[model samples]
Target: MNFFKPVAAVALGAALSASTAITAFAADTTLVISSWAPPTHGMNAKMWPKLTKMIEEATEGRVTAEIKYKLAPPPAQFDLIQDGAADLTWIFHGYNPGRFVATQLIELPGYQGSAEAASVAYWRAYEKYLKSANEHRGVKLVALHTHGPGQLHSSTKVTELDQIKGMKLRLGGGVSGAVGDALGATGIRVPAPKVYETLASNAADGVMMPMEGKKGFKLTEVAQHSYVMPGGFYRGSFALIMNQEKFESLSKADQDALMTVFGEPASRMAGQVWDEIDAIGVEATESTADNSLNTASEADRKAYDAIAAPIIEAAIKAATDKGVDAKAAVEFIASDMAAN
Candidate 1:
């Protein structure tokens, strides 16, 4: 009787093991993406869905991704991916401070062109110059992009450049912090998700962000005025990253296929999404009652140019310290943007 019981137990264990293996083989590799933005934000609504579709098409549905929001705070995204808590995530370069210097190259002010052009230039520049920095050392970098030009959105009317002085503004770090300093504004550092509440509670007088914020974060309701500069005060740098081990564990064919859709392609798509959402933000501001958009006068533009030159020089120096010829890289980006 004891021998019969042992044999039955062994048979059941073998059957269960076979069942588990079959289940694993038949399932698609579902990548859990941790996102910090609200579900309605452009990053969540359009960009992530587009990326997931690209991944599915590239891998022929063998792999897929789903976004899981609020798994961690904004600044914690990189660490989350590194720890394998999430298979993928997008991170704003300026959020972490001191951890991303070369990335500042893309965030510097005075780059002309739409976000799409600048983003393509960014990926090209990364290949030629910024890759040496290894700033994103722990994860697999899927894409790099910049948002539309950063402008001022305020709860109170801001008609002149000089009016920014002493106002507490939410600055998303990198060159934006320096720009705020140059304008004599007091800077409040916060993740993008917190900006709405910060402004709603009067914790900040204004926020410097891309136009997408007008709709993406519902800034149109709280921040009723926008002070726009032709090229904007600055741009925000962002990167889409995946867990290195997770990327490598994929079948080699799938890895190569995913690469075809990542990098430049992904960057371009993200930028296009930014362009779309920026337009939406502009429309929202225009259609919303009592909201106003004011462009800087030519005099303010000239003065801002002067203020921006020194900040640009400082960013170049910072990138140069990372062993990148940032001046050349900047020129390359400009010329490339112009070409577009």
Candidate 2:
């Protein structure tokens, strides 16, 4: 009876080990990541490749990430990720304004000082404050980041608040359009691809985009004058997200490895890279004939902020209507930026 018991125990242990091995093998899987850039943009050129390499090596090739570039334009990235057309992709929250009302807290004016700091703060806030609700119900948020300070690039020079008045400015999304309205410019919502043609044809006089836009979209060729404000009027927010179903299907080990590469450190690295690329864009723009850069005066900045403040206040009120404690969130972001 003792011999039979020992053999039974050994067989049971072997079966358990084999089951575990099979489960682990089944969990080892590959995920597809897509992006709007053509693998030449700064996000693709500097960050994604490094992240993919880290993910693959960390998982010992058990988990692989395949990047498909230029799968769609910027506006389509969110839907692509959400619908599982892509397992993971970057999303510009500002592109779909009403879709992400809570995350829009990050886009408010005067809250973020630098992209690195802001990106870190945004992730912290989302995890600590925003995620409790059903804000991002159907997706796994990998990172939240933003570009450097958004500025004005124009065909003609804009030296003051008055100069921007009545100018047709090609702005990216609702937040920028609000900034344009505050500055009294006629905001035109055009895709980034169409910006150069629009400016060249006199369809738009200027654009409110990151400084990098000058080089990325070749806006420098057509719009030679860049009007930089003292501080950013507003910055846009973006997300790296995975489909919920896709994320759940990953092994626990692979999930942990992916999360390790995301969060505040990754966002800070991304923001710094964007800032460096923005400087390069500025240099490239400056190298062109007839291109120039100028900073607005204190008084001009004050005038512009005055207009922006009211718009921001109205946004807060609107957010309050949606059950968010907008005032507290705004105050917290402001205090955090000031302290940091």
On lDDT, the leading prediction is 1
In candidate 1, how many Å is residue 288 off? Answer: 0.4
User: Which residue pairs in candidate 2 have backbone atoms (N, alpha carbon, C) closer than 3 angstroms, thus clashing?
Assistant: none
* Clashing residue pairs in candidate 1 (N, C-alpha, C atoms within 3 angstroms): none
- Stretches of candidate 2 above 4 Å error? 1-28
Per-residue lDDT of candidate 2, residues 1-340 (tens digit): 3798889899999999998777544426667888775566777787676666666666766776678877778888877777888887877777776777766677776765777777777777766656654556678877788887888999888777788889999987857778888778898887776788899999999898888888877878888898888557678778878888887787888778777776776676777777877887889878988899988898977787778787688777766777777777777766666666
Give each model's whole-structure lDDT: 0.94, 0.77
For candidate 2, give the lDDT of residue 327.
74
- List where candidate 1 sits over 4 angstroms from the true fold: 1-27
Candidate 1 minimal-lDDT segment of 10 residues:
19-28
Clashes of each: 0, 0
- Which candidate comes out best when scored by TM-score? 1
